[model samples]
Target: MKDLELLLKNIKNKALLPVYFLHGGESYYIDIAVKSLENDVLTEDEKSFGQTVLYGKDTSIPEIISLAQQFPMFGELNLIIVKEAQDLKLGEDELKSLEFYVENPVPTTVLVFAHKHKKLDSRKKITKILTKNNWIFLSEPVKDYQLAKWIADECKANQIKTAPNISHLLADYLGNDLSRIANELGKLKMVMKEGQELDEKLVETHIGISKDFNVFELQKALGNKNHAAALRIAFFMGKSPKTNPFPMIIGNLYNYFSNIIIYHTMHGQSPQVMAAAMNVNPYFIKDFAESARFYPLKHATRIISLLREADLKNKGLGANQIDDAELLRELTYKILNVDRLKVSV
Candidate 1:
């Protein structure tokens, strides 16, 4: 992420590079980088004659090199962007050609490889050359636990204020799709009042994630051992299968209980220490502490097993023709009473 911020800053400052080999499993950053270089490096009139876009499947490394070797027709520089560079078939000859071009790229051309959804082999010579020159940008995907903080940071950067737990609520619903999350945030920014802070109600109104019936609330209910509240939430979620997918529900529960187990191990530690250990925001430390108190380490471990069993049943492994709604209800019941169940830890 620092590399991305630096890359954007450089582009904004017009500190151009000859060749940018942007390869990564996350396409959001790749798209942003490609757009910045394509738009910022060339003036509007200059882009007419100085820019060329190509796709990996439709071209070869030799052809790209040939384009890069060309001088700008009308401006001080030429821009050649190769989108979906990951799909290009790179054999030994192609690798050699790429390595040669990267080693001695033309000064008048800014060549970019917008590789997405995968990373180039690190052991490759061309990869090393690009990395050594600081021309490579590897955009790794954000982990699930880190999504909330990423959301909060983005909001702060955009001057969009949010209430506590709003980021967590969004993270639970949106998962880890950064692009989708950004789009939703953009929508919120557009509709928010001049000084309005985004809260659970606003998010639910705009994003369609129910504040009361979401997995986060369900987790809280179960953590507090409020059996009736947990069942109510589970039943509502089960009725609306499209909004609350069974697998997602099970996955969230699994993460929740896993964090509780972690909390047990880090008991008596400072909130900061526990939050870091669990990869969660310190704001939610009390929630984890309360959950750990109710479930304890052994019960939390057993709940994880129950979640896995429900997952298998949802997949029809041994479900006896049970639907997801029933499975969710049963899973919720089991998790709420996991303390009372006689099971191995």
Candidate 2:
């Protein structure tokens, strides 16, 4: 729970110690940590004299130490940043040397070890040495419950106000990829007035969600049994390359029907019980509930079979000239009960 503001303040004030290990699961923290060093640690003139960025896999500890040992050309200290330090060759020998260096790091140098993706093994001798001797900041990913708050905080930092639900919707649509989420939010920030609230329509218009529609959200609407809403989304998606990218669409379709099948199979179970039984998030139970209302176990099985055929057609089997848009529209009409079934007289 390290404070981002405190870290930024230390970087800007030049009050930070020489050695810093910024390793974490959250990309937002890792990105901010590195950028703060780049922008605030040294002046442009100081950077030209002593700043060096090195990749861990390519550069050994000896090489890093060699550079760190050198005095700044005309600056007070050198700044050595090791990106993706998890890939850096840090064996026993290197760890011993690094431990010693960290203990007595040159006052004329600043060494920053950045390990992104996941946390480095702090239990290791090298990591243990670092914790006892230098500044160590461990960043963890935001919990699912905290994601909306995190996004809201990010917007607030930029002096923008995002509607609460909008944040969750963005988080829901973007998945859990922090970098991608940040990119989308950054794009949204540009088009929004400073004090204006961001809404779903604003997101739809500016973010360029599939003009024709995407399987992702369409699945959500259908699962929730909002048939009308689902149909509208389906029609919109009919305008896009989504239908053209038949394989991807088919994949999503297959997953949706499969989940519905699973829900029906496990009907009469509690949300927790169903989630555990089907290996899905509990948050998805509502959609499954809605889907169960519209589809019996038998109908769910039939839809799953239809999706299987669609998958094959998209894969260039059976139908050689199956147009994605046409196939998808036909499927939508059937799914939404818009098309009447024919009976033998």
Candidate 3:
């Protein structure tokens, strides 16, 4: 799969391929590629007659082939785009027709398949042909652990300065939704002053995620065994169910303690080694080290069990009509005092 930049650069240099099969699990990159082809391939005057957009659900392979075979009416080339190509149902004859067209596509017509949210069937001959010719672009989803770096890269690409932890903060709040994170960054960029860096305060003000009271802060409080601070944040989070969903909080805690257990077992290793083992940034190794001191392997394992019980309770199993706030309070108390509570593993 070619990178989006390389693809756009090719189109910019007038080195256009006969066919572009943009299919993927991530729609953000796919949409960007499709838009670039739509706008960059032809001028406004040329697009009036040269450009044609078709939906996969409404068009067939034979129809696509027929269009691709035709020359441009008013411009030097014809640009044919098929959006939502994943929804295009294929039969035996249609598959053969597509494979035939891809193998010997028309040079004067540029055909693009904007297949979003899924990839082409690798088992199909057409997919193999696309790959062999470098015509396919696969936009794989970014992993949860990679979101912070992705955010940081995006900030850098936009020529924006940010605090070291700002990317991590945004990643924690936004999860792995590239489109939503990009939208929030776009909003921040609009209101940002000249030469202003994006810090936690700016993010809290613009993105609605509190600098203090978020899952990252709550994790810090728990890692250091600050009982008072943990309870305060938990209480605040419980009050705002929409912002801090109970299940997401529990899931984050589960991941936190699970990493602590891994850290305990990796003693004496370098920060980089441990960070790689835990899938966390090396900058956070010190924090994890402090957390490991507070939570031994046995304690961390037991806390994970406690988190599982809390998750079940949040799902209304054995909860006895307790509200999320109260459940959160009880769970926080148990986690902070795991040794004394003798939480079963």
Candidate 4:
């Protein structure tokens, strides 16, 4: 978040806050805030006496406050960070004890709370005080379409060059878990030369994703009306069901054509309008604009239906005769046929 970067800069400049509460589903920014405190809050000699880290399972909020009330020893600030604060065995009453500490916090102590995955009760007075004072940060998930742009930015932050649209390939394979994506990107960068441009081949080699046989490529083939290529990739998927499961393939297709269908229904809206309506990157509007020919409004609608039905079948709710691989081949065949004429599956 913008506030997070500002807070980090302030910490680096020794502009300290008495209390910090970082709660989020995505832990990337939370980790950054914690690391900033570790690196910038105290000197190497000061860290020996000025830093304390605790886990929620073993520490109480009252105990943490007591620790925070301690005076710094030969340092400008004493940093006490609490990780996984969500697991703390505390109810509203126990949490309220923090209100007193927050109201009259120690000048020498900087208390940081890394509450991962969930937020504390906002109705509580403690939450109200922290938020009003600008101490709480919630890390919202990156939008589904924004993942690629975020990945591209991350590549730059790591000093790695990436070929165009490589972020799209990574987003298609990795989903929107920023922590996991960073881990994979770190691995990919390790195997490359220092300044090598991250390409499809590098990703396929280091990240174990298929450059040619992934669902994104499958979608591209279908969008271009290349039935042979679509079927070929589907067969590759069939041979390796462990890696490419039916649900992920179906989910990707559902997202892919549903947007194309949205573009057609908008009926002559500008590319910018459709991009905003569909929450898609503006650069990809042309692909969906062209895709209207391969899968017209009527066919795109039916293909989504086929995908839904196949999803149910794979789940043993409607039908479960074939495995995911065979199910995918059938789904691809039906989608490609929708290009020729209206199809039913």
Best by TM-score: 3
Give per-model TM-scores: 0.92, 0.66, 0.93, 0.91
lDDT of 3 by residue, 1-345 (tens): 247888888888878999999988998898888888987899999998898899999988888999999988787999999999988878889999999999889989999999988888899999999999989989999988788899999999988889878898888778788999999999988888878999989998998988888888889999999999999999998998888888878878888898898888888889899889887779888998999989889999999999899889988898798888899999989889988977666
Which runs in model 2 stand beyond 4 Å of their true positions?
A: 210-226, 232-345
> Deviation in angstroms for 260 in model 3?
2.3
Per TM-score, what order, best first? 3, 1, 4, 2
Tens digits of per-residue lDDT, candidate 1, 205-265, equal 9999998888888899999999999999989988888888998898888888888998898
Which residue runs does candidate 3 get wrong by more than 4 Å?
none
lDDT string, candidate 2, 214-259, tens digits: 6656776666556777777766666676332555566556666777
lDDT of 2 at 237: 66
- Predict model 2's lDDT versus the native: 0.74
Candidate 4 on 1-345: residue-level lDDT in tens? 557778888999988889989887777888888899989988888889999999999999888988999897676788999998888877776767888888889988999999988767788888899999988888667887789889998999988898876888888778888889999988987888977889989888888888888888898999998989999999997887767877778878898899988988986888888888877667888889888887778888989888888898898877657788888888888888965655464
The residue pairs that clash in candidate 3, if any, are: none
Model 2 TM-score, 2 decimals: 0.66
Candidate 4 positional error at 170, Å: 1.3
Better of 2 and 4 by lDDT: 4
Stretches off by above 4 angstroms in model 1 are 296-298
Return the clash pairs for model 1, or none.
none
Residue 299 lDDT, candidate 4, scale 0-100: 85
lDDT, candidate 2, at 251: 55
